[model samples]
Target: MKLVIGGAYQGKRAYAEGHDSIQKWANGETCPEEEIFSCEGMVDFHLYLRRLLQEGKEQYVREQLIPKLLQENPGIVLVTNELGYGIVPIDPFDRSWRELTGRICTELAEHADEVTRVVCGIPVVLK
Candidate 1:
């Protein structure tokens, strides 16, 4: 899998699209949860995690999300906002969502074949 991350509106999606040549992209905000396992690429992946958390699927987040994606769509391209750069949120759920997103992204980066960080529309490869 390839992970593309950056601040919101940094053009991560455009960069991923330009680089990956994927034909079918899923928007995590609207696509069904299971679509991640089959889509060629996905944007707004952080929102997907938030939905899972809101639904109290902590176990799936901790135990299955990474493994299932790696197994089912190892070549998928994921574009997610980098949620760790800003000030901490005050709400408990917001805080948990940020932290969970960080942890999950870390693991995803570790296993990803390529990790890219986009800043001001430029991509900096991390791995």
Candidate 2:
């Protein structure tokens, strides 16, 4: 598996696209929740995580969904925003989301075959 992270609109999707021929691309903000599992990989996974949190499904995501996806698709690539670099959010939920996202990213990075951080459309490999 591969993980790509960067700030919002930093061309993370473009970079991922350049690296692989993604057949399943789902937008976290708009894709139907049921359809998310059918996707081979995820772009803007932070947004999807937020959606899960909003729906009180975070536990399911952390315990079931992510593991299931990774097990089913070992080559899946996840693209997410690097949420820790900006000013901390004022809302408690936002703060929790940021923290959880960081933990998730850290875990993914540890297991990923490749980890990349994109800045200004340039990718820097970290693992």
Best by lDDT: 1
For model 2, the stretches where C-alpha displacement exceeds 4 angstroms are none
| lDDT tens digits by residue: candidate 2, 49-124 | 8988999987886777767766776777889999999999999999989998998888888888999999999999
- Which residue pairs show backbone clashes in model 1? none
lDDT of 1: 0.95
Candidate 2 C-alpha error for residue 71, in Å? 1.3
Error of 2 at 109 (Å): 1.2
Residue 80, candidate 2: alpha-carbon lDDT = 95
Q: In terms of TM-score, which candidate is strongest?
A: 1
The superposed Cα distance between candidate 1 and the true structure at residue 24, in angstroms, equals: 0.8
Global fold similarity of model 1 (TM-score): 0.98
lDDT by residue (tens digit), candidate 1, 14-85: 999999889999999889989999999999999999999999998899999999899889999999999999
The 0-to-1 C-alpha lDDT of every candidate, in the order given, reads 0.95, 0.86
